[model samples]
Target: MGWLWDNAVTLATIVMAAAAVAALVYAHLSITENRAAERRANANELWRERS
Candidate 1:
């Protein structure tokens, strides 16, 4: 476990990078879901106007 203590900085950097990637992915999914919901609402409004 002495090696782990010596490489703590490297391990922390990797963990930080993984967290950043996960945050980006979460943001992307949230944006996509919002866009899809907006499109559905728009389609419904258009259908109602046509009817």
Candidate 2:
């Protein structure tokens, strides 16, 4: 379509921005999950030591 052709660059920019945002969200969630797992492991270790 003529309209799509005219706005091709704008569409591409929006797509790239969305992809970047998605990547950042995925990275943040992964880091949070890893931190939670680390805390759980530390707690377990402390419990074992006390027992």
Q: Stretches of candidate 1 above 4 Å error?
A: none
lDDT of each: 1.00, 1.00
lDDT of 2 by residue, 1-49 (tens): 9999999999999999999999999999999999999999999999999
Clashes of each: 0, 0
TM-score for all models, in order of appearance:
0.90, 0.94
lDDT of 1 at 31: 100
lDDT score of residue 47 within candidate 2 = 100
Give the C-alpha miss distance for residue 41 in model 2, angstroms: 0.5
Q: Name every residue pair that clashes in candidate 1.
A: none
Predicted structure 1: lDDT: 1.00
Candidate 2 residue runs with Cα over 4 Å from true position: none
